[model samples]
Target: MKKLSPEILEKLKGIKAVVFDVDGVLTDGKITYDNKGMEFKSFNVKDGQIIKHLRKNNILTGVITGRDSRVVRNRCEELKIDFHHHGIEDKFNVFFKEMSRRNIAADQVAYIGDDINDLPVLRIVGLSATPADGHYKVKEEVDLVLSSEGGKGAVRELADLILEATGTYDLILKKQ
Candidate 1:
C-alpha cells in the first residue's frame, strides 16, 4: 500500500460506509456471455473476505452499478450487503437515496469507482478511490489508486487501508 498523506488519512478515518462500482471496480471490466445468453462474472475471494471483515466491524458497505446481473445480486447476498443498487441509469441518485435512507452523510462515505459514470458520486464522497487499472480520468480524480487492479484485490487493499486509517485493522487482526 502507498503511504497516505495526513489529509487523505483524515478523510478515510471518518468514512463509515464504502460503496463500489461493479463492472470495472468489482470485476476486471469484462463481460462474458455464453451462446445461451447466460452471463458470468469473476470476483476476488480476498476482496470478499475484506468486505466481510468490514461488515463485522460495523462499517457499512454496498454496491452501485449501471448494469444489473443475477451474478451480482447473488454475490451481494452471499456477502450480506443489503445496500446494493444495480441497473441504475443515474448512479448518483442511488448513492444519494441510499445514503439518505441510511442517515449517512456524504463525508462519511467512501466511493470506489473505475469509469466515467462513477465520477459523479466519487467526486462528492469523502474518500474516492480507484483501481490501478481504472480509467485514466477516474484514476486522475481519485484520492487513492491502489496498486492492485480491479477484481484482483483492489477492494481488499482499500478495505485494509480504511481499517488502518480508523485504527481498527490491527485490532481486528489481533482478535482473529
Candidate 2:
C-alpha cells in the first residue's frame, strides 16, 4: 500500500460508507465466457475478508456496477453488502438515491472506480480511489491510486486504510 497523507487520512476518517464499481475495481475488468455461455469473474478473498469487519464497525458497504451477472450477485450476497445495484447506466443517480435513502451524506462515503463510467459518483464521494491498473483518466481523477491491481488486493488496500483511519483496525484485530 502507498503511504496515505495526513489530509487523506483525515478525509477517510469521515467515511461512513464505501461503494465499489465491479468490473475493473473488483475483478480486474475481465469477463470469461465458458463454452456453455456461462460467465465467471475472479474476486480476491482478501478483499472479501475485510467486509465483515467493516460492517461490525458500523461502516456500510455496497456495490454499483454497469454490468449484471449472477456471479457478481452471489459475491455481493456472500459479503453481505448493504446495497447492491447492477446493470445501472446512470450510476450517480442510483448512488445518490441510495445514499439519500440511508441518510448518508456524500461527504461520508468513499468510492472506488476504475473507468470513465464511474466518474460521476466517484467525483462526489468523500474519498475516491482507483486500482493501480485503472485507466489513466480514472487514476488522474481519484484521490488515491492504490498500489494493488484489481482482483488482486485493491479493495483490501482501501479497506485497510478505512479501518485504520476510523480507529477500528486494532479493535478488529483484538478479536482474532
Candidate 3:
C-alpha cells in the first residue's frame, strides 16, 4: 500500500462503480464491416476474467456504447454484467440513469472512455481513465492513463489496477 500523489489512490478507494465506453476503450476502436452492412468486434478473454472478479467483489461493473450489437449484449451476459447501455448518444444521461437505478452516487463512480463523445461523462466522474493508445484529447483529461492499449489487454490492465488499488486483487489471487 503506497501513498497516492495525484489523489488517485484515495479516489480509487471510494469508487463503488466503474463504467466503460465500448469501441475505443474496450475493443481497440476497430470495426470490421461486411458487404451487407454487418459489423464485428473482438474482445479479449482476459478482460472477461477481470470484470468477473470485479463483480465477485461487489464493485459495480457496466458498459455504455453508442453502437448496438448482439455481440456486445451476449458477451456482457456471459460476463455477468447486466448494467449495460447501448446505442446511446447522450452517454451522460444514460450513465446517471443507470447510477440512480443502481442507487449509486457520482463520487462513487469511475469512468473509463476514449474519443470526444466520452469526454462529458469522463469530466464528471470521481476518477477517469483512458487507454494508452487513446486519442490524445481523451487521454489528456483523464485521471489515470493506462499503459496497455485497448482490446489488447487494456481492460484487464485497468481492472487489475483498480483491484490492486482497492487492496482486493491480492486477496482474490490468494483465494485462487
Candidate 4:
C-alpha cells in the first residue's frame, strides 16, 4: 500500500461507505471466453476478506458495474455487500438513489473506479481511488492511487486505509 497523505487521511475519516466498479476494480480487467462461450473472471480472496472486515466494522460496502454477470452477483453475495447495483447505464443515478435511501451523504462515501464511466461517482465521493493499473484518466482523477493492481489486493489496500482512518484496523487485528 502507498502512504496516504495527511489530507487524504483526513478525508477518509468521514467515509462510511465504499463503492466499487466490478470489472476493472475487482477483477484484473480481463474477460476470458472459452470455446463453450462461457465468461470467466478471477477475483482475489484478499479483496473479499477486506470487504468482510470493513462490513464487520460497520462500514457499508457496495458494488456498481456497467456490466451484469452471474459471476458478479455470486461474488457480491459471498461478500455480503450492503448494495449491489449492476448493469446500469448511468452509475451515478444508482449512486444517488442508494445513498439517499441509506441516508448517507456524499462526503460519507468512497468510490473506486478504473475507467471513464467511473468518473462521475468518483468525482463526487469523499475519497476517490483507483488501482495502479487503472486507466490514465481515472488515475489522474483519483485521490489515492493504489500500489496494488486490481484482482491483486487493491481493495485490501483501500480497506486497510479506511480501517486505519476509522481507528478500527487494530481492533480487527487483535481479534485475529
Give TM per candidate.
0.97, 0.97, 0.93, 0.97
- Which 10 residues in a row give candidate 3 its minimum summed lDDT? 1-10
For 1-176, candidate 4 gives per-residue lDDT tens digits of 24778899898888899999998889999999899988899999999999999899888999999999988999999899998987987999999999999999988999988899999999999999999899999998889889999888889899899998889989998998
Candidate 2 has an lDDT of 0.92
User: Which candidate leads the pack in lDDT?
Assistant: 2
Residue pairs in clash, model 2: none
Which is superior by lDDT, 2 or 3? 2
Q: List the residue pairs that clash in candidate 3.
A: none
Cα lDDT of all candidates, in order?
0.91, 0.92, 0.86, 0.91
Clashes of each: 0, 0, 0, 0
Model 2 agreement with the true structure over 1-176: per-residue lDDT tens digits = 25778899899899999999999888988899999999989999999998778888999999999998999999999999999999999999999999999999999999999999999988989999999999899898999999999989899999999998888899888989
Q: Where is model 1 more than 4 Å wrong at Cα?
A: none
Most accurate candidate by TM-score: 2
**Deviation of model 4 at 4, angstroms:** 2.3
Candidate 1 clash pair list: none
For model 1, residues 1-176, the per-residue Cα lDDT tens digits are 46889999899889899999988878898889999999999999999999998998889999998988999999999999858887988998889999999999998999999999999998999999999899999989989988989999999999999999888999988988
Question: Model 4, which residues run further than 4 Å from truth?
Answer: none
Error of 2 at 101 (Å): 0.2
What local lDDT score does residue 50 receive in model 3, on the 0 to 100 scale? 90
